[model samples]
Target: MPIDIETFDESSSDELNTLTNAEMVVRFLATNDDKAYTPSEIAERIDIKKNSIGTVLSRLEDRNLVRHKGDYWAIGERETVRDAYRTHRIMEALDERYGEEDLEEWREHAAEGE
Candidate 1:
C-alpha cells in the first residue's frame, strides 16, 4: 500500500505558515461553529498534534474563548470571538507601525493592585 501526499498552492502555503496553532484551531472552530468536535477531530482536520490540542483548548476555555462539553468542543460566543479578533488585528497594526512592545518595559510600568 502507498500513502497519499497532499499539496498546496503558494497562497495557501503562505497562509498556513503564518498562523499559530491557537489561531488555526480558533479559525477551524469558527468556520464550523455550527458543529462541535472532539480534540482528535480538530487535530486531524487542522493537521496539529493531538497532544497540543488539549493545552490549546484548555487555555481557550479558561479565557472563555471556546466552550467544551463532555468530550466535544465548540467556539464560544460570536461577539466575544469577534472582539478578540478585532483586538488582535489592532495589535498587529500597532506592532507594524511602532514596533512590538517590550514586555519588560510594560511590566515595569504596569500598575500594582492590592
Candidate 2:
C-alpha cells in the first residue's frame, strides 16, 4: 500500500518545522505522490533554496526514497525503496567483513543455482 498521509502530516507547518530540509522534501513528495514536481517548485513549497535542493534531492535519490521522471521528481515505490535500503545496509555490513567479491560469491551461493 502507498504510505498513509497521516504518517507525516503535510498540512501542519508546525510539524513541518520540526523536520530537516531533506525530511521536509521527502514528506512533501510522499504526500504529493499523485503528481511530480520540479526542484524549484519543491523548494518553494518546502521553504528551501532552489539552488541547494539538488544535494537534498540527490541524497534522497541515492537512498531510493525519490525518483525522477524526465525533469520532474517524485516519490519512489515505497516497498521497493524499503527493500533496496535494507539490501544496501546488508551489503555494506557484509562487504565490511568479507569484501565485495566474497559477498558476490556468497550471494551466488545463496541463490542455489537460480
Candidate 3:
C-alpha cells in the first residue's frame, strides 16, 4: 500500500497548527469549571469531533487534569490543573527555544528497566 501526500493551503495549515484536542478540551472545561457536561455537550461547545472526545477525556482523567462521573466530565482540582497547565507552557517555551526533543533518541538511550 502507498500513502498519498496532500498539500495544505495556508488557511487549512493554520487550522491544522492550532491547539490539540486535549488542550481544547482542558481549556473549555476550565473556562466552565462550575459545570460538568456530557462528552457530546463538550464536543459541541468546543467544536471538536464528538467521537474523539471520549479518548481525550480519558487521557486527561489519567493525568488528573480532568474528572469524570456518570456520563459527565469536568476540570480536575484547581491546583492540579494549574500545575499541569504551567508545566505545559514551560515545555512549549523550551521547545520553541531549542528544537523539540527527539523521542526516538531518548528511547534509544533509556535504561533497560525503563
Candidate 4:
C-alpha cells in the first residue's frame, strides 16, 4: 500500500500541545539516539537557545533515560531501547507529512492517539 501522509496530522489531541520545551527536547534526543545519532548530529538538528540541549541532556541523565558515553549519549540502563526504536518508527511514519518542527508539535498529539 502507498503511504498516506495525512494520517499523522489529523485526529490529534490537546495533550500533544502540552508538551513543554524540555519534553520536546527529550523526545528529540530519544528519537535520534534510536536512529544511532551522535551528539554532533543532534546538535545540528535542534535550533534552540544556547545550552538548552545541554540542560535537556542533563535532565535526561538525571531521569536515567540517557547516559554520557564519552562525548556521545547512550541509552540508560533503566530505559527501554525499544522505545527509541519505536520513536524512530513513528518518525519514519510521520516524516512524509510533517517537517521536524511539526513532528515535535505532533508528539503529544500522537502520544494522545493522533
Candidate 5:
C-alpha cells in the first residue's frame, strides 16, 4: 500500500514528488511487509488514481516484485518463495540419484567438521 497521505507526517510531498508512479507504489508496498492490498486500497493511501492502480500493479507483477492471490495483492520475491522454488528445483533434479538417509548422514558429518 502507498503511504497514507493524510496520516503521513512529512511536512512536504518532496519525497513522493520525485518518485515515478511505479516507484511510489513499490515503496508503499515494501513498507507494509507481507500485507495484501487491493487497487482501491492503494489509491486511497497514495497519489495514484484508482484507475491507475491496476496498471501499476500489472507492471510490478511483470517485474516479479508483486503478485495477486485471488483478489488481493502481496509482495513477491520474498525469501521463502525464492528458497522454496530453488529447493524444489534442486530436489527434483537430484532426488533420484541420492537417498534421503545418505543426505542426512552427509549433512551431519559436514556439521561435525565445522
Candidate 6:
C-alpha cells in the first residue's frame, strides 16, 4: 500500500533531519550495488559537489561503513545492513501523501472497459 496523505501530517521532521552526510552516502550505497563507487560517481548521482562527496566518503571509510575493493567501493565489514522492506513501507507512506493514484491495489479496483 502506498503511503497516505494523512500519514504525512503525523510524520516528524526530526526523522528527515536525522539524515546526515554519511547517511546520505549510506542511502546512495543502499540504492546501488554492493560494489565500490567512486566519489565522482556519488557526486554525480547525488548532485553534491565532488569535494563534498570526497569528504563524506573519507568519513564513511574511516568509520568502517565502506571499504575499497578491486577498483570498487564495497560495503565495509562493519556496515550495518538496511531493511529494504521497511524502506518500502516508508515509500508507500510518502506516495500516499503525494496523492499518487497508480497504487497496485487501486488499479485492481478499477472498472473494466469503462
**By TM-score, who's the top model here?**
1
The TM-score, computed over Cα atoms with residue i paired to residue i, of candidate 1 is 0.80
Error of 3 at 39 (Å): 0.4
| Per-residue lDDT of 18 in model 2 | 54
Q: In candidate 1, which residue ranges exceed 4 Å CA deviation?
A: 1-16, 108-114
**What are the per-residue Cα lDDT tens digits for candidate 3 across 19-79?**
6899778877887889999999999887889999999999999999999889989999999
lDDT of 4 by residue, 1-114 (tens): 111244235324442444544555555555455644455555456545545667777776786677786667765653454575467558856874675566576787888884
The C-alpha stretches of model 6 lying farther than 4 A from their native spots are: 1-13, 78-114
Q: What TM-score do all the candidates reach, one by one?
A: 0.80, 0.57, 0.79, 0.44, 0.53, 0.49
- Evaluated against the true structure, the overall lDDT of model 1 is 0.82
Which consecutive 10 residues in model 5 have the weakest lDDT in total?
Answer: 6-15
TM-score-based ranking: 1, 3, 2, 5, 6, 4
> What value does the lDDT take at residue 11 in candidate 5?
23
Instruction: Please list the residue runs of candidate 3 whose C-alpha ends up more than 4 Å from where it truly belongs after superposition.
Output: 1-17, 111-114
Candidate 4, overall lDDT? Answer: 0.56
Q: Model 3 has how many clashing residue pairs?
A: 0
**Candidate 6's TM-score:** 0.49
- For candidate 5, the C-alpha RMSD (Å) to the true structure equals 14.9
lDDT assessment of candidate 2: 0.77
* Candidate 2 runs further than 4 Å off: 1-17, 80-114
- The per-prediction tally of clashing pairs is 0, 0, 0, 2, 0, 7
RMSD in order of candidates:
5.6, 9.5, 8.8, 12.7, 14.9, 15.8
Per-residue lDDT over 1-114 for candidate 6, one digit per residue giving the tens place of the 0 to 100 score? 122354346445654455556665666675565556777876676666777876777777786667675545655553243453356457868876886567676767775434
lDDT against the true structure, per candidate, is: 0.82, 0.77, 0.82, 0.56, 0.69, 0.61
